[model samples]
Structure formats: structure tokens, C-alpha cells
Target: MHSFSIILLPLLSLLPSTISQTSGTFNAMTFNVAGLPAILNDNGVPGDKTANTARIGQLFTQYNISLIQVQEDFNYHATLYANDKHPYRTATSGGVPFGSGLNTLSNYEFTDFARVKWNTCSNIDSADCLTPKGFTFMRVKFAEGVSIDAYNLHADAGTTAADTTARASNLRQVSDYITAHSINNSVLVFGDSNSRYTRTGDIPSIFSTANGMKDAWLELVRGGVAPQAGTDALLCDNPSPNTTCETVDKMWYRGSSAVELQAQKFQYAGNMFLQENGDVLSDHDPVLVDFAWTKV
Candidate 1:
């Protein structure tokens, strides 16, 4: 009995630290609020900006989503709606009033914040031309000497060749920024990418290879099914039998070898943001992902 106990104790001590303690868990979401000034009164899709803003706050409370990346948040929505709610925030629209439409809100205090406007955009798409689309970088300190870099972006939206090219360029800029700025390679890029894993382009490939990041939805939902990617949880509006869903809003993460990142759960929070009359809060559904981090 003494000999057996000695051998078992040594084997147990050899187990990885992940088997003993978990660092923490946090939830992240990427939502395109579609809070543009022109679309605020356009029926139930956009809904009333004020009411929709309230619903957005409700979503944060209901889900306890700690980190959020919002796109198309114009008209001081980031300041009026998010600043008071998130506590930690960064927002910019390229110095234009209601222009860039990118913001990052976090439960943790931000150590650093910056915005990078795209050098080029789709000339054919008037919407893209009017709005100054770009990516925002945020550094949040979770603990002493522990931080994560987050990049929020909203790429050009369209299926045309010019639009696709612009999207690829946007992705490249993001990748380059990550390469240059991300400390310890622990980073997350989330927002309305307008590019999918199934699409044929450098956007997906650049992230998979250059950034060493995995799509949170694909990595967690499909049971780690390599090369398989799809997000049909919810589309622009409420869930319907005839509604066709696609993967547009997404989250990607990369963790160092010392820190193991696992996706505990992923869901579409469109239902939570719906009005009592069944109207959606925004034109784009929010993608929420819960992640568990452990020291390896």
C-alpha cells in the first residue's frame, strides 16, 4: 500500500497545471448595431435609435458580455450608449462626425487605445465611400503583467470584385498591425469582417496562417472540425423559417503557449436584443462567445 501511494502521488504531481486551476472565463461579442442616422426610422429593422440603444444595454446585462466590438455605431452612440455602460471604452470615426463607426467597449480598464483608418476603400460602393471604415486597437489589462490586445474592425461590405479586394486589403492591414503591435501574440480580432471562412480570398487564410488565430465560431461550434466553417445561428433580423443566415460577424483569438484558450460556448444573441413587438434591435445579429483561459 505504501509503495502504490508513492507512485500515484508522483504521477499526480506530473499532471499539467490546467488540470488543477483555471485562470478565468470571459465572454466577447461583435455586433454591428446598424445605428446609422439614415436608417434609424426605417421600420423595425433598425428600430428607434434610442429604444435600440436601450436594448443593447439590456443585452450586455443579460449576457454579462465583458468585451464588445461594435461597428456602424454612429451619432455618438459609443459615447451616449456605451461609455456609461462599459466603463472602459475607445471610439473613433476618423475625426468625422458619425463617420468611422468603430468602437470597442470592455469591462476592464484599457491600457492603450488607437485607431487605424484604411488607406483605401471601395470607390464603387457609395456607402463605403461615405463612411470612414477602419480598425481600432485596444489593450486591456486583466491582471498584473497580463494583458490582451483586441482589434475591432468593419470591412467594406459587398460581393463585387472591388468590394472583395477592399476587404482583403482591410484584412491585410489588420494582420500587419497585429504582427507589429500584439504583445505575446495574445490577441483577439472581432467585428463585422464581411468576410467568411468559406469565402475564397486572403482574408481567411491570412488570419489562419499569419495571425495563428482561430475563428471562435468554427473552432467551438463544429467540434474542432478543421477546414469546416459555417454560422447559421441567426441573420440580420429575427429567426425565421425562411430566413437565410450567413457568417459575417466573427471573433478570432490567439493565445500564447503558456495560456491555453478554449471556447466554452458560442451563441447568437439576436433574440435577447429583440423588442417586445418582435422587432430586432439592429440589422446585424450579435455573435457571443464564452472563452475559458487556463495557465498551461
Candidate 2:
């Protein structure tokens, strides 16, 4: 009887932990597709719209991406691609006219979707004025009753002080929006920040510290190798002939204590996504992050 009681107690203790373990995992990706006409006019790397759209579709299968955030998709190329390849049930494109080039694609159905254009933008670069650039917010369900607020953003691009300030403002807008609207404080933000983690006063640092969000890449270094601040992982348009490799694309998220989120893997999906002639899929390398949510 004593031996039977001991064994029964041990098995009972394991039931709670096993039942509370993570139910599933999902993968997310953020890429600046450079589909806007301005970027294409600058260089012909990605080539024709039809071919670029096809390659983008193939990447969804190659990476098994569950959620995607894309910037510079002003041409509606992302919308067409998502419809043809991915099984995304819900999607939202940035506003029209002076709409932001941001777009969010998700496997789960979206309960709510919205976009906010930055009040301030880069005055120095004429390209920045071409279209309104901002962030898109979406609510997606991952499990039976689990959902998260997802944000896709594209900040001002340029080296000038105005660009830096505009980028900071964009981060502030996103942070404030999530704080006020996010359900359960579970939020995921990803896109082309045009800011670097290595920079002292960058938008990434500001958003994380001020909003209680964590950078997925820094939290989970790929291959167990710690990345060098700026140069280790570069997601720029052109990798070759570039001395300083900067990480402009990023992913960040926040989850309540009851449900903690952890990044399982983080990497740049560049080599695999390329044309037969070796031309890249997009100007910027698509960044992938595999993460799981578990009960604490």
C-alpha cells in the first residue's frame, strides 16, 4: 500500500505540468519587398513584378510562415501573392491615396484591423513623401481561445536627423496604440524599422524599454551563436560590397506573465530565396522568427 501511494502521487504531480505545456508553435516573417515603383526605378535586382510575386509566394511555403508583415508593398503585389499561395484567412493592406505601404498577412482570421500614418515624415528625401508610411495593427487568433495583436510598421528612411526623429515618432505611435488597445497585453510588432539595435539612441531600444517589449532575435540567438550588435546579421537591400552590415528589419513582442512567449529560432532567409540567375527575391532579406507561447 505504501509503494502504491508513492507512485500514484508522483504521477499525479506530472499531469498539471503536462496539460499546461505549449499547445503549438508558429513562425513569423517580416520583409521589405521593395515593390514600390520608386525602389524599382532605382535598381532592377528583383526584376519584373510577375516573377517577384511568384518567388515571394514560394517563400511562404519554404519558410512555413504563419504570419507575415511586409513593407513597400504599395503595388498590391503582396495582396495578390497572399491570395494565390498562402492559406491566410485574413489580411489588411495599408490605406489608399497617401496610404502607408504596410501590409499584414495572417493564417488566422483577423478580428480587427487598422492603420495609422505617421504625423511626421522625412522632409529631405523626396521618396519618403511619395506615399504615406506608417503602421498596421491586426488581431489574430492562434489557438482555440488565444489571440494576439500584431503590428506591421515602416519608418522613415534616410540618414538625416529628420528621418531619425520621424522613426522615433513612428515607434511612439505604435507603442501608444498597443498600450491602449492590445488585448491581454499580448502584442507582436515587426517590419522595416530603419533602425539598428547597435545604435545607442535607436527606435528599437526606445520601443523595447518604453513599451515592455523584447526583441525576438536578441532573446533567442540563432544556432546558439550570439550576434554581433550591428554587423553580424544584416538585412539590407544589397549585401555584397557593403562594409557595414546593418539590421534594419526586426521583430518584437510582449506577453503577460500567465502566458509567456519565447523565440525558438531567428535567422535571415536570404540564400534560399533567389532567382535562377542568383538575383535576390527582394532588396532586403526576409527575417524569420519561430516562437511558442506556453502557460507559465
Candidate 3:
């Protein structure tokens, strides 16, 4: 009996630690809150920024969503998700203004935040032949040296070849930023991208080629291989009844190696910044994903 006990104890000791090195979960939301007054007026959506903002606060309370990456306008939308107890830290790309486009929010204190402007169309150049920087990247510090990145973006509608090209350029640039920096073990990029999967360009290319980055929606929802979907269960409006509008708002994660990604389901919470009326607060819908990190 003693010999059997000795062998069992050794096997148990060999098992990996169940306690996460940096345990605890974080919820992230990406909403395209189109300006303020427009959202409030029934002319836009049933729930204006004010009402939706209140809803957002309530959501934050209910879900305990800490990391929020909001597109459209960071400065203006920041007001919608503010509370004394649940204050948020923010970062925006310069010159974006109240409605200039692109912004991110976070419940964690920002250790450092920087803007990586993508190439964009210019007023000086021919409208069809210009490229502009796209989106803003922010890094937030959590307890115990753990940190993650949130990118807020609104890519140009890929209605034209020029717009598509610009978006591709911006997506690549964001990847460059990630590749250049030494991000901690965990990372996430979320926002409203006017483009869909297999559309060709930035995100698709990155997910296909970038070793570390992978699409959350595709992995968790489409693939059904992860747990994060529980927090992002809401579906975007399918304008075309015959077609399933694959998600445009999404989240991506960095794998253990620049060549391999380790993604799993956390939870899926759909459209956090939504109004009661059918009308959408913004032209696009918001998506939320929660992640649990364990240091290896």
C-alpha cells in the first residue's frame, strides 16, 4: 500500500499548476457608437448615446466588463461609459476629434498607450489613389505584470479598390506595431471593421499569415472550438436575408508562438451598447468577448 501511495503522489506532483500565473478574467466590448445627439434622437436609434451609455454602465456592472474598445469617437463616447466607481481609462489617435473616428476604452489603468496611424486617403491626392493610417492601439496593465492590447478601428468602407487598399495597408501596419513591440503573454485586438472575412486585405491576411494573431469569431463561433463565445453570443444584423453576415466587429489573440495560436472559449456577450428599439445605435453592431489568461 505504501509503495502504491508513493507512485500516485509523484504522478500528482508532475501535473501542471491549475492556478493561473495571472489568473482572473477580463471582458472587452467594441461598439461603434455613432456620435451623440444622433443616437439619442429617435431619428437615429431608440437608445441614444445617453440611454445606451446608461445601458453600457449597467452592462459593465452586470458582466464586469473591464476592457472596452469603442470605435467612432473616443472623446465623446467616453462620456457614455463613465462612472465614479467604474471609471475608464482611454487613448485615441491624434486629430480624430469628437467624430473623426477610432477610439478605445479600458477599465484597467493604461500602463502605456500609443497611436499607430495607418496610411489613408488624402484631400490633396486623387481620392482614388490615397492611403491613410487606420485605427489606434492601446496597452493596459493589469495586476501582476500582466497586460493586453486593444485596438479601436473603423476601416474605410471597402466600396472601392482604393478603400480596400488603404484598409489592407492599415491592417498590415497594426501587425507591424505588434511584431515590433514586446507585448506580454496575452493580447487582444477588437473593433468595428467595415470589411468581412475572406474579403481580402488586412485582417484576413494577418490571420492567415501572421503567426501569433488569430480571429476570435472564426475560432470560437465559426469553428466552435473555444469557450470565449459565451460572452459574445449576439449576432449582427443580416441585411441580406439569404446571406449570413459574418461578423465584422471581432477580436483577435496572440498565440504562444508567433507561429501558433492557443485560443479557447471564454464567453460571448452580444451588442452591449444596444438600444431597446429595433434601430441600431450605430450603423454597425457591438461585440463583446471575455478571456481568461493563465501564465505559462
Candidate 1, 17-71: lDDT as tens digits? 4354448888888988766675433424645676777677666766667888888
Runs of candidate 2 with Cα error greater than 4 angstroms are: 1-22, 38-40, 43-46, 76-79, 89-97, 222-245
**What ranges in model 3 sit over 4 Å off?**
1-21, 36-58, 81-85, 91-100, 122-133, 183-185, 200-203, 224-245, 255-272, 276-279
TM-score of 2: 0.79
Candidate 3 on 135-159: residue-level lDDT in tens? 6666666554466655666555544
Instruction: Give the 10-residue window scoring lowest on summed lDDT in candidate 3.
Output: 122-131
User: What order do you get sorting by TM-score, best first?
Assistant: 1, 2, 3
Clashes of each: 1, 0, 28
Measured against the true structure, the TM-scores of the candidates, in listed sequence, are 0.80, 0.79, 0.69
| Predicted structure with the largest TM-score when compared to the true one | 1
Worst 10 residues of 1 by lDDT: 235-244
After the best TM-score superposition of candidate 3, give how far the Cα of residue 213 lies from its true spot, in angstroms: 1.4
